[model samples]
Target: MDRDEAEIVALLRESVRQQRMWLMVVVGGAVVAGVAAVVLLPGARLGAPLALAGVGVFLGVLITAPQRKLLAQLGLSRERAIELLSRADIAGRTPEQLRERQAQRRTMWRVVTAVTTVIAVIAIGYVVSQAGNRVDDNVPGSGPTALFGWALFASAVAGITAIVGFVQLSTFASLDRAMSAEGDEIAS
Candidate 1:
Protein backbone atom coordinates (compact mmCIF):
# COMPACT_ATOMS: atom_id res chain seq x y z
CA MET A 1 0.00 0.00 0.00
CA ASP A 2 2.90 2.33 0.79
CA ARG A 3 5.91 3.40 -1.27
CA ASP A 4 8.24 1.28 0.88
CA GLU A 5 6.11 -1.81 0.31
CA ALA A 6 6.19 -1.18 -3.41
CA GLU A 7 9.98 -0.86 -3.34
CA ILE A 8 10.26 -4.09 -1.41
CA VAL A 9 8.06 -5.88 -3.92
CA ALA A 10 10.09 -4.55 -6.81
CA LEU A 11 13.35 -5.63 -5.23
CA LEU A 12 12.00 -9.06 -4.41
CA ARG A 13 10.64 -9.47 -7.93
CA GLU A 14 14.00 -8.53 -9.41
CA SER A 15 15.72 -11.06 -7.18
CA VAL A 16 13.37 -13.80 -8.33
CA ARG A 17 13.84 -12.80 -11.94
CA GLN A 18 17.61 -12.98 -11.61
CA GLN A 19 17.39 -16.42 -10.03
CA ARG A 20 15.18 -17.68 -12.85
CA MET A 21 17.59 -16.35 -15.44
CA TRP A 22 20.49 -18.07 -13.75
CA LEU A 23 18.62 -21.38 -13.55
CA MET A 24 17.60 -21.20 -17.20
CA VAL A 25 21.16 -20.57 -18.25
CA VAL A 26 22.47 -23.45 -16.19
CA VAL A 27 19.81 -25.95 -17.16
CA GLY A 28 19.84 -25.03 -20.84
CA GLY A 29 23.61 -25.19 -21.07
CA ALA A 30 23.74 -28.50 -19.24
CA VAL A 31 21.08 -30.13 -21.40
CA VAL A 32 22.65 -28.98 -24.66
CA ALA A 33 26.16 -30.01 -23.67
CA GLY A 34 24.95 -33.39 -22.42
CA VAL A 35 23.10 -34.20 -25.59
CA ALA A 36 25.92 -33.01 -27.81
CA ALA A 37 28.51 -35.00 -25.91
CA VAL A 38 26.49 -38.20 -25.97
CA VAL A 39 25.76 -37.82 -29.67
CA LEU A 40 29.21 -36.75 -30.83
CA LEU A 41 31.22 -38.96 -28.57
CA PRO A 42 29.30 -42.18 -28.39
CA GLY A 43 31.33 -44.93 -26.66
CA ALA A 44 34.01 -42.33 -25.84
CA ARG A 45 33.30 -43.14 -22.13
CA LEU A 46 34.73 -39.82 -20.90
CA GLY A 47 32.16 -37.59 -22.45
CA ALA A 48 29.86 -37.28 -19.45
CA PRO A 49 32.25 -35.76 -16.97
CA LEU A 50 34.11 -33.69 -19.51
CA ALA A 51 31.04 -32.15 -21.03
CA LEU A 52 29.09 -31.63 -17.80
CA ALA A 53 31.96 -30.26 -15.76
CA GLY A 54 32.87 -27.86 -18.53
CA VAL A 55 29.30 -26.74 -18.76
CA GLY A 56 29.12 -26.29 -15.00
CA VAL A 57 32.18 -24.07 -14.93
CA PHE A 58 30.93 -22.05 -17.86
CA LEU A 59 27.50 -21.57 -16.29
CA GLY A 60 29.03 -20.58 -12.97
CA VAL A 61 31.10 -17.86 -14.56
CA LEU A 62 28.22 -16.58 -16.65
CA ILE A 63 25.95 -16.27 -13.60
CA THR A 64 28.54 -14.83 -11.24
CA ALA A 65 29.78 -12.19 -13.65
CA PRO A 66 26.35 -10.74 -14.20
CA GLN A 67 25.49 -11.02 -10.51
CA ARG A 68 28.60 -9.06 -9.63
CA LYS A 69 27.76 -6.43 -12.21
CA LEU A 70 24.23 -6.11 -10.89
CA LEU A 71 25.45 -5.80 -7.32
CA ALA A 72 27.79 -3.00 -8.33
CA GLN A 73 25.07 -1.21 -10.23
CA LEU A 74 22.72 -1.56 -7.27
CA GLY A 75 25.36 -0.13 -4.90
CA LEU A 76 24.88 -2.99 -2.47
CA SER A 77 27.32 -1.74 0.11
CA ARG A 78 26.90 -2.40 3.81
CA GLU A 79 25.75 1.15 4.29
CA ARG A 80 23.19 0.81 1.57
CA ALA A 81 21.77 -2.37 3.12
CA ILE A 82 21.39 -0.55 6.40
CA GLU A 83 20.01 2.49 4.65
CA LEU A 84 17.43 0.54 2.73
CA LEU A 85 16.22 -1.20 5.83
CA SER A 86 15.84 2.10 7.66
CA ARG A 87 12.58 3.06 6.01
CA ALA A 88 11.30 -0.27 4.74
CA ASP A 89 8.73 -0.94 7.48
CA ILE A 90 10.83 -0.82 10.57
CA ALA A 91 13.81 1.04 11.95
CA GLY A 92 17.26 0.09 10.72
CA ARG A 93 18.81 -3.04 12.14
CA THR A 94 21.69 -2.82 14.54
CA PRO A 95 24.96 -4.76 14.28
CA GLU A 96 23.41 -7.52 16.31
CA GLN A 97 20.49 -7.65 13.93
CA LEU A 98 22.84 -8.03 11.03
CA ARG A 99 24.74 -10.78 12.79
CA GLU A 100 21.56 -12.59 13.63
CA ARG A 101 20.43 -12.37 10.03
CA GLN A 102 23.75 -13.85 8.91
CA ALA A 103 23.57 -16.63 11.44
CA GLN A 104 20.09 -17.53 10.28
CA ARG A 105 21.26 -17.56 6.70
CA ARG A 106 24.18 -19.79 7.57
CA THR A 107 21.87 -22.17 9.36
CA MET A 108 19.63 -22.36 6.35
CA TRP A 109 22.58 -23.04 4.07
CA ARG A 110 23.84 -25.75 6.39
CA VAL A 111 20.51 -27.53 6.30
CA VAL A 112 20.34 -27.40 2.54
CA THR A 113 23.96 -28.48 2.20
CA ALA A 114 23.42 -31.41 4.50
CA VAL A 115 20.44 -32.59 2.53
CA THR A 116 22.24 -32.26 -0.77
CA THR A 117 25.26 -34.11 0.57
CA VAL A 118 23.11 -37.01 1.66
CA ILE A 119 21.51 -37.20 -1.76
CA ALA A 120 24.89 -37.05 -3.46
CA VAL A 121 26.22 -39.84 -1.31
CA ILE A 122 23.26 -42.02 -2.14
CA ALA A 123 23.69 -41.26 -5.81
CA ILE A 124 27.40 -42.07 -5.71
CA GLY A 125 26.72 -45.30 -3.89
CA TYR A 126 24.16 -46.33 -6.48
CA VAL A 127 26.52 -45.58 -9.34
CA VAL A 128 29.41 -47.42 -7.73
CA SER A 129 27.23 -50.41 -6.93
CA GLN A 130 26.03 -50.61 -10.51
CA ALA A 131 29.53 -50.22 -11.86
CA GLY A 132 30.73 -53.07 -9.62
CA ASN A 133 28.11 -55.38 -11.07
CA ARG A 134 29.97 -55.47 -14.39
CA VAL A 135 33.12 -56.68 -12.66
CA ASP A 136 31.21 -59.22 -10.57
CA ASP A 137 29.58 -60.61 -13.69
CA ASN A 138 32.85 -60.47 -15.68
CA VAL A 139 31.31 -59.13 -18.87
CA PRO A 140 33.73 -58.22 -21.70
CA GLY A 141 34.26 -54.50 -22.28
CA SER A 142 32.61 -54.13 -18.93
CA GLY A 143 35.58 -51.82 -18.72
CA PRO A 144 33.87 -49.19 -20.85
CA THR A 145 30.57 -49.44 -18.99
CA ALA A 146 32.32 -49.11 -15.66
CA LEU A 147 34.27 -46.14 -16.87
CA PHE A 148 31.10 -44.56 -18.19
CA GLY A 149 29.44 -45.07 -14.84
CA TRP A 150 32.26 -43.27 -13.09
CA ALA A 151 31.98 -40.49 -15.59
CA LEU A 152 28.29 -40.12 -14.82
CA PHE A 153 29.06 -40.02 -11.10
CA ALA A 154 31.69 -37.39 -11.62
CA SER A 155 29.35 -35.35 -13.76
CA ALA A 156 26.71 -35.42 -11.05
CA VAL A 157 29.26 -34.33 -8.48
CA ALA A 158 30.48 -31.53 -10.69
CA GLY A 159 27.00 -30.21 -11.35
CA ILE A 160 26.04 -30.36 -7.67
CA THR A 161 29.26 -28.65 -6.67
CA ALA A 162 28.71 -25.94 -9.21
CA ILE A 163 25.21 -25.08 -8.01
CA VAL A 164 26.12 -25.21 -4.33
CA GLY A 165 29.33 -23.31 -4.94
CA PHE A 166 27.38 -20.56 -6.63
CA VAL A 167 25.00 -20.27 -3.68
CA GLN A 168 27.80 -20.22 -1.11
CA LEU A 169 29.95 -17.70 -2.96
CA SER A 170 27.13 -15.24 -3.53
CA THR A 171 27.84 -13.12 -0.48
CA PHE A 172 31.49 -12.79 -1.30
CA ALA A 173 30.65 -11.93 -4.88
CA SER A 174 28.43 -9.08 -3.76
CA LEU A 175 31.08 -7.82 -1.40
CA ASP A 176 33.69 -7.89 -4.12
CA ARG A 177 31.44 -5.89 -6.40
CA ALA A 178 30.75 -3.33 -3.69
CA MET A 179 34.45 -3.01 -2.93
CA SER A 180 35.25 -2.55 -6.60
CA ALA A 181 32.79 0.30 -6.77
CA GLU A 182 34.33 1.91 -3.74
CA GLY A 183 37.79 1.63 -5.25
CA ASP A 184 36.57 3.26 -8.46
CA GLU A 185 35.03 6.06 -6.48
CA ILE A 186 38.28 6.66 -4.61
CA ALA A 187 40.33 6.68 -7.83
CA SER A 188 38.04 9.13 -9.57
Candidate 2:
Protein backbone atom coordinates (compact mmCIF):
# COMPACT_ATOMS: atom_id res chain seq x y z
CA MET A 1 0.00 0.00 0.00
CA ASP A 2 2.87 2.35 0.81
CA ARG A 3 5.60 3.62 -1.55
CA ASP A 4 8.19 1.30 -0.02
CA GLU A 5 5.89 -1.70 -0.38
CA ALA A 6 5.18 -0.80 -4.00
CA GLU A 7 8.87 -0.42 -4.75
CA ILE A 8 9.73 -3.76 -3.14
CA VAL A 9 6.98 -5.48 -5.09
CA ALA A 10 8.20 -3.91 -8.33
CA LEU A 11 11.76 -5.02 -7.68
CA LEU A 12 10.66 -8.53 -6.83
CA ARG A 13 8.57 -8.77 -9.99
CA GLU A 14 11.41 -7.41 -12.09
CA SER A 15 13.84 -9.94 -10.65
CA VAL A 16 11.47 -12.79 -11.43
CA ARG A 17 10.91 -11.53 -14.96
CA GLN A 18 14.63 -11.20 -15.62
CA GLN A 19 15.26 -14.71 -14.38
CA ARG A 20 12.47 -16.10 -16.58
CA MET A 21 13.89 -14.30 -19.59
CA TRP A 22 17.27 -15.79 -18.85
CA LEU A 23 15.75 -19.26 -18.79
CA MET A 24 14.07 -18.65 -22.16
CA VAL A 25 17.35 -17.52 -23.69
CA VAL A 26 19.06 -20.65 -22.40
CA VAL A 27 16.34 -23.00 -23.71
CA GLY A 28 16.08 -21.26 -27.07
CA GLY A 29 19.83 -21.39 -27.65
CA ALA A 30 19.93 -25.09 -26.84
CA VAL A 31 17.03 -25.87 -29.17
CA VAL A 32 18.51 -23.96 -32.09
CA ALA A 33 21.92 -25.51 -31.64
CA GLY A 34 20.42 -28.97 -31.43
CA VAL A 35 18.50 -28.47 -34.68
CA ALA A 36 21.55 -27.16 -36.47
CA ALA A 37 23.73 -30.04 -35.26
CA VAL A 38 21.22 -32.57 -36.50
CA VAL A 39 20.84 -31.00 -39.95
CA LEU A 40 24.47 -30.02 -40.52
CA LEU A 41 26.42 -32.99 -39.20
CA PRO A 42 25.01 -35.97 -41.02
CA GLY A 43 27.07 -38.76 -39.45
CA ALA A 44 27.68 -37.06 -36.15
CA ARG A 45 26.08 -38.51 -33.09
CA LEU A 46 24.69 -36.34 -30.24
CA GLY A 47 23.33 -34.08 -33.07
CA ALA A 48 22.94 -30.30 -32.95
CA PRO A 49 20.60 -30.42 -30.02
CA LEU A 50 23.21 -31.68 -27.58
CA ALA A 51 25.79 -29.29 -28.91
CA LEU A 52 23.35 -26.42 -28.59
CA ALA A 53 22.55 -27.61 -25.11
CA GLY A 54 26.21 -27.33 -24.24
CA VAL A 55 26.32 -23.82 -25.59
CA GLY A 56 23.23 -22.93 -23.65
CA VAL A 57 24.73 -24.27 -20.45
CA PHE A 58 27.89 -22.26 -21.04
CA LEU A 59 25.95 -19.05 -21.64
CA GLY A 60 23.87 -19.63 -18.55
CA VAL A 61 26.99 -19.87 -16.43
CA LEU A 62 28.37 -16.73 -18.00
CA ILE A 63 25.22 -14.82 -17.12
CA THR A 64 24.91 -16.11 -13.57
CA ALA A 65 27.46 -13.74 -12.04
CA PRO A 66 25.48 -10.73 -13.11
CA GLN A 67 22.26 -12.37 -12.04
CA ARG A 68 23.62 -13.01 -8.57
CA LYS A 69 24.68 -9.40 -8.25
CA LEU A 70 21.22 -8.25 -9.21
CA LEU A 71 19.67 -10.58 -6.66
CA ALA A 72 22.02 -9.42 -3.92
CA GLN A 73 21.21 -5.80 -4.62
CA LEU A 74 17.51 -6.46 -4.55
CA GLY A 75 17.77 -8.42 -1.31
CA LEU A 76 19.88 -5.77 0.40
CA SER A 77 17.49 -3.01 -0.63
CA ARG A 78 14.52 -4.92 0.69
CA GLU A 79 16.26 -5.83 3.91
CA ARG A 80 17.33 -2.24 4.52
CA ALA A 81 13.80 -1.00 3.95
CA ILE A 82 12.48 -3.55 6.39
CA GLU A 83 15.11 -2.55 8.91
CA LEU A 84 14.16 1.09 8.55
CA LEU A 85 10.48 0.35 9.08
CA SER A 86 11.19 -1.83 12.09
CA ARG A 87 13.46 0.78 13.68
CA ALA A 88 10.76 3.42 13.17
CA ASP A 89 8.25 1.16 15.01
CA ILE A 90 5.91 1.45 12.06
CA ALA A 91 5.57 -2.27 11.33
CA GLY A 92 3.45 -2.68 14.52
CA ARG A 93 2.65 -6.23 15.59
CA THR A 94 3.79 -8.08 12.46
CA PRO A 95 7.60 -7.97 12.83
CA GLU A 96 7.88 -11.38 14.43
CA GLN A 97 5.56 -12.86 11.82
CA LEU A 98 7.64 -11.31 9.07
CA ARG A 99 10.80 -12.82 10.50
CA GLU A 100 9.18 -16.23 10.62
CA ARG A 101 8.14 -15.90 6.98
CA GLN A 102 11.68 -14.95 5.95
CA ALA A 103 13.06 -17.97 7.78
CA GLN A 104 10.64 -20.20 5.92
CA ARG A 105 11.76 -18.64 2.65
CA ARG A 106 15.38 -19.37 3.50
CA THR A 107 14.56 -22.98 4.23
CA MET A 108 12.70 -23.29 0.93
CA TRP A 109 15.66 -21.80 -0.95
CA ARG A 110 17.99 -24.36 0.58
CA VAL A 111 15.73 -27.17 -0.55
CA VAL A 112 15.52 -25.75 -4.05
CA THR A 113 19.30 -25.42 -4.25
CA ALA A 114 19.82 -28.99 -3.10
CA VAL A 115 17.40 -30.29 -5.72
CA THR A 116 18.94 -28.17 -8.45
CA THR A 117 22.43 -29.41 -7.61
CA VAL A 118 21.28 -33.00 -7.98
CA ILE A 119 19.58 -32.31 -11.31
CA ALA A 120 22.62 -30.51 -12.66
CA VAL A 121 24.85 -33.41 -11.71
CA ILE A 122 22.54 -35.82 -13.50
CA ALA A 123 22.44 -33.64 -16.62
CA ILE A 124 26.24 -33.42 -16.75
CA GLY A 125 26.53 -37.17 -16.46
CA TYR A 126 23.96 -37.68 -19.22
CA VAL A 127 25.71 -35.25 -21.52
CA VAL A 128 29.09 -36.84 -20.92
CA SER A 129 27.78 -40.33 -21.60
CA GLN A 130 25.99 -39.25 -24.75
CA ALA A 131 29.11 -37.54 -26.04
CA GLY A 132 31.27 -40.55 -25.33
CA ASN A 133 28.86 -42.91 -27.01
CA ARG A 134 28.70 -40.75 -30.13
CA VAL A 135 32.46 -40.50 -30.34
CA ASP A 136 32.84 -44.28 -30.01
CA ASP A 137 30.30 -45.02 -32.74
CA ASN A 138 32.15 -42.99 -35.35
CA VAL A 139 34.57 -45.00 -37.52
CA PRO A 140 38.35 -44.67 -37.08
CA GLY A 141 38.94 -42.22 -39.92
CA SER A 142 40.16 -38.60 -40.03
CA GLY A 143 36.61 -37.24 -40.40
CA PRO A 144 35.41 -39.25 -37.45
CA THR A 145 38.44 -38.12 -35.47
CA ALA A 146 37.66 -34.48 -36.28
CA LEU A 147 34.04 -34.89 -35.27
CA PHE A 148 35.06 -36.66 -32.10
CA GLY A 149 37.48 -33.87 -31.29
CA TRP A 150 34.80 -31.25 -31.76
CA ALA A 151 32.42 -33.21 -29.60
CA LEU A 152 35.07 -33.59 -26.94
CA PHE A 153 35.73 -29.85 -27.00
CA ALA A 154 32.06 -29.11 -26.69
CA SER A 155 31.71 -31.56 -23.84
CA ALA A 156 34.61 -29.95 -22.06
CA VAL A 157 32.97 -26.56 -22.42
CA ALA A 158 29.78 -28.00 -21.03
CA GLY A 159 31.64 -29.53 -18.10
CA ILE A 160 33.19 -26.21 -17.26
CA THR A 161 29.79 -24.59 -17.44
CA ALA A 162 28.40 -27.22 -15.11
CA ILE A 163 31.20 -26.52 -12.66
CA VAL A 164 30.46 -22.85 -12.80
CA GLY A 165 26.80 -23.50 -12.20
CA PHE A 166 27.59 -25.65 -9.17
CA VAL A 167 29.88 -23.00 -7.77
CA GLN A 168 27.28 -20.30 -8.29
CA LEU A 169 24.68 -22.45 -6.64
CA SER A 170 26.90 -22.97 -3.67
CA THR A 171 27.64 -19.29 -3.47
CA PHE A 172 23.94 -18.53 -3.47
CA ALA A 173 23.28 -21.11 -0.79
CA SER A 174 25.95 -19.65 1.40
CA LEU A 175 24.59 -16.18 0.83
CA ASP A 176 21.19 -17.39 1.86
CA ARG A 177 22.58 -18.88 5.01
CA ALA A 178 24.44 -15.73 5.87
CA MET A 179 21.36 -13.63 5.26
CA SER A 180 19.29 -15.90 7.45
CA ALA A 181 21.84 -15.66 10.22
CA GLU A 182 21.85 -11.90 9.98
CA GLY A 183 18.09 -11.81 10.03
CA ASP A 184 18.01 -13.97 13.15
CA GLU A 185 20.45 -11.68 14.86
CA ILE A 186 18.42 -8.65 13.94
CA ALA A 187 15.21 -10.23 15.11
CA SER A 188 16.76 -11.10 18.46
lDDT per residue as tens, model 2, 4-122: 75565555556657778888887777668756876787656663567657876778777565556754765555566446444544345465665565567656656655665565566
TM-score, one value per model: 0.44, 0.35
- Clash count for candidate 1 is 0
Candidate 1 segments exceeding 4 Å error:
1-12, 47-55, 78-122, 130-140, 146-188
Error (Å) of candidate 1 at residue 45 is: 3.6
Instruction: Say which candidate scores most in TM-score.
Output: 1
Per-residue accuracy of model 1 over 53-154 as CA lDDT, tens digit each: 686787777666654564465656545544554555234666456556656766676666666666566667666666655343355555545345545555
After TM-score superposition, the amount by which residue 95's alpha carbon in candidate 2 deviates from its true location, in angstroms, is 2.6
Given candidate 1, what's the lDDT at residue 9? Answer: 39
Q: List the RMSD of every prediction in angstroms.
A: 10.7, 8.7
Instruction: Please estimate how well model 1 matches the true structure, expressed as its whole-model Cα lDDT.
Output: 0.61
Please give the CA lDDT of all the candidate structures.
0.61, 0.60
